[model samples]
Target: MTVDLIAVVPRNSRGRGVQRYYDAQSECAFFVSEPSGQPELWHRYLDGARDVYRRFGVEQALEYDAVADGASTSLFFAALNADGDMVAGTRIQGPYTDARQAHALVEWAGRAGADDLRRMIADRIPYGVIEAKGAWVARDAAHRAELGAAISRTVLHGARLLGARYGLATVASFTVPRHEACGAMPAERIPAVPYPDERYRTVPLWWDTRGYSAFAEESQRFSTQAEQDALGLTAVRPLDARCGAGRAAESRRGHGR
Candidate 1:
């Protein structure tokens, strides 16, 4: 559900001589950029995500292709604590040419024999789309709700900035509530389905980027100004200059699903 990025007033911080900004929604200081130039940082977060995936006995590791895809054409939205430790993060891939070439969708459909799913996505090709994947939070992070919300909006806003009409994700059942809070709904006719991976049972979902109104709806749910402020965020700003340059360079490198 399209998160309101402008809900929070952001403040800048200077630490370790590294430029950083505070994300009120996530309640953590962070830096958002591409993975290529930040290999160690990227892998550190990936390791955390991998650990989470392992605990569930689901997909425990990322394939080479997945890593290459991310390094070549994805943005990293990471949440960091005061010690500059990345506690949670997520990756987003493309404004793709078609469904067949997009990340995870094609293989997932093939595994599930979801030809109709593929066709539905192909039909919507005229409207640009992106896939959100590899989201994970450190085992010990405070304000988990706010961190999830922060990651959700970061990917949503990132997709919008790249001119995508929608953002897609294959999320685990447990994570559906968080996605719903961010305005993500089922991409399939059935809201949640058994994924081919019996371990995780992740379900496909998507959120509209064009003319979304959930921000207005969500804003009204809060009673006082303080409550509202706590849930607010400067949504799109994190994906500003530095983030753009990375994606722009990756886009120039090549285009893939």
Candidate 2:
């Protein structure tokens, strides 16, 4: 079938089945909404991001996009079958404002014996954690493998392109939530982070190939065709969203214990 990835705006997301699919999975979850069990997921992701930065000597930092602002995000696209259905999906948490460290990263790659690797990440590091957010295709044994490969490659290329465009880096660490059949896929040259458990092993389409900090204010979503065009790859976007109103009435928002 024809697989296409499109942006699902907030107002229009009402009937997109995103909420319904989430609800179904949330039935036995820790929270009535998304999984808040481990506030550490974000930490782990950032840690992983920074870990990649050390080699590049980039000033690594983390940005948390908690609210859905209709901006760019990681979402999957799977073609519908005979039955007018399109429930397969995937999502990764990042592109966390880190793209300005490529010059050094590219150099680092060259020093490491992979000039192509430097070039691959000179733009973006298709490296970030990914987990299958939703997928109706998992039920079918026949279509599962193809779908998995499609998704993994999709994720990889998205990260690569984004990294290249923004001068950022990323890692595709899939410490995903549950999905047994998905884990069966072979790990390509890219390394994999062990999944949490059966219930949490969400499918990881792929990881970012490269930095930890500095981002381009002009990041975009993972274009479905872009990934395919890259032959497999992975960026960050501007993240200056703010809601400043009557701040005097409140106080401040910064990092502190």
- Against the true structure, what is each candidate's TM-score? 0.69, 0.30
lDDT of each candidate versus the true structure:
0.57, 0.28
> Runs in model 1 with CA error above 4 Å?
1-21, 64-72, 110-113, 190-193, 215-257
Candidate 2 residues 1-257, lDDT tens each?
33222222222232232211111111110000122222222223233333433433332222223322312334333323323233233333344434233322322332332343333333333433222222223343245544444443334343443343221222323422111121112222322222222222212222322211111011112322333333332233322333343331121121000
Any idea what lDDT model 2 has?
0.28
The digit string of per-residue lDDT tens for model 1 on 106-174 reads 436535536655765676678787877778777678778777766666555556656776777777778
